[model samples]
Structure formats: structure tokens, C-alpha cells
Target: DLSKNNKQMDKIQKSLEAFLENKRKEFPRFFFLSNDELLQILAAAQDIRKVEKHCSKIFCNIMKLKLGEDSNSNQIYAIISAEGESVAYQPPVKARSEEKIEATLTEIEQKMVETIAKKLSKFYSEYDFTNIDKSSWVFNDIGQVVSAFSQIIWTELC
Candidate 1:
């Protein structure tokens, strides 16, 4: 089975290499990074904390996005600041297409649902859901539970 897994991994590595090669063709700066570094960046793109260390490598400086809240409206805002390693970091000015942006947002939403579900796994497992009779609601997907939890969170926050 280990050999089989190794074969599969090899195939995956080849596919990933092809994809990254295409990406590098579009933006040649990627050539500066090794396969492992590029893979790390792609894998940790979902979490800023995880990807922060790699910022210096990709951007030539460490950058951080801090979250601040408005006291009056209670709205959250991001403040981008350069860290100690901030030198020669010319951040990209290019904008992705609207379709690509929407797709990335959807991916983020899905990842959030999965993360929340994992964090609440113990409560979800212990709680009985059979009693709640939903006349119109369809409880087919895990994201549905997250949507319901979002409503509860909104109610509590408001």
C-alpha cells in the first residue's frame, strides 16, 4: 500500500508541477521559489497566520494585516502594515477578474464552514437533531448547519 500511495503522490506531484509551471509562465517571479516553497504558499493561502512567515520570501519583506474594530459602528477593518523585514517589498497591483474573485470568496466560505464544523464537532455529535421538525428547511449539507449557526451568531451579536 505504501508503494501504491507513493505512485499516487508522484502523479499528484507531476500534476501540481504542470499547474505551477503554467502559473510561472504567466508570472515569472515564481521561478525564484522552489517547489516546496510554492507548495507551502498555496497550501497556507487560506490562513494569514500560517502564511505570514513566507511573506518575506515571496514579497521580499514581511507584511501583516491587522484587524481593527470601529467602536461606533462595530465594523471590522483590515490595516496592512510592513513588519521588521519590510524592505524592497513591492506588492502586486494587479487585480484578478471578478469571476476569479468570487470563486476565491466562495472557497473561503466553504473552508470557514468546514473549520467551524470541525471546531464544534463535540457539540454537534452530542446534540440531538432529530426532534427539530423543519417544514421548509433542507438539512442536506454541512454548510447548512453553519448557515444556521451564523443566524444564531448574528442574533447574539446584535
Candidate 2:
């Protein structure tokens, strides 16, 4: 059986599709962003969004470590909360030792770096940084590339 949330999502999708169809009739080239660029933009956006979403968790975990918690409960909660907003934290009956917590945090940091690397691989494959026209492009070129699709985002609305 389809969950209520799923059903609601389906209805929303159908409505959006209908609205888009009408818009397409009025504007054939409704989507201004290039398809390939759009994908890269979205991929980069997700990474930045993920980082921004979990920054507090990461910061809190580091603070807890500095505070000498001597347990992995807070760190685990940080990871879970960072990864999934819906996740609930339940402190372990047996607390992890300080050494264990440090080791685990080290591992988590490595994994986070790895996840970022994986997400960036697709973008790196597309852009040729070595061949960039550095003279013409300024410091924000990289950011510009990431948000190339949504140029308006980088532009002033007013």
C-alpha cells in the first residue's frame, strides 16, 4: 500500500506536471538552464546544502570532543542528526571511551571527506580547470561555474 506521504507527493507531482505543461505551451524554452550544466549545478548545490545543513552538528561534535565527553553518544547523535533530520538520538547504554570516540570521529571526518570527493568527481570530470581562462575569470569563477545554471542566484534581484 502507498503511504499517505507518497500519495500526497504523487498528487503534487501531477499538479506540477500540469502547470509545467501549460507553461510549456506559452514558453517552449521554459527552462533557461542547460541540462548538463543544470545537473552539475544541482549536484554541487546538494553538497553545499548538505554541508550547510549539517554544519551545526559537525561544530557541536567538535565542541563536545573538546569538552572531553568521554563518550560517543553526542558524536553519534551529531552524525545521525547531520545525515538525517528525521533521525532520533538514543544514548548508548554503554558509553564509548574517549580514545574510541576520537577514533570514531577521525573515521567520520575521513568518510565525510570521501563523500564530498565522490559527489565532486562528477563535476571535476566535466570542468577542465587546467584549461581555464584565468585571466578573464575572477576569483568567484568556481562558484559561478557551480551555479552557472542559476545565474539569477548570483545576481542581485534589485
Best by lDDT: 1
RMSD of 2: 19.3
Which ten contiguous residues of candidate 2 have the minimum total lDDT? Answer: 59-68
Q: For candidate 1, report its TM-score.
A: 0.35
Model 1: ten consecutive residues of lowest lDDT: 86-95
RMSD of each: 18.2, 19.3
User: Which candidate number has the best TM-score?
Assistant: 1
Judge candidate 2 at residue 117 and give its lDDT. Answer: 54
The per-model lDDT (C-alpha) reads: 0.45, 0.38
The estimated TM-scores of all candidates read 0.35, 0.24
List candidate 2 stretches off by more than 4 Å.
1-99, 126-158
Model 2 lDDT tens row, 21-73? 55434433324433443333334432332222323433332222111154222
Candidate 1 backbone clash number: 0
lDDT score for candidate 1 against the true structure? 0.45
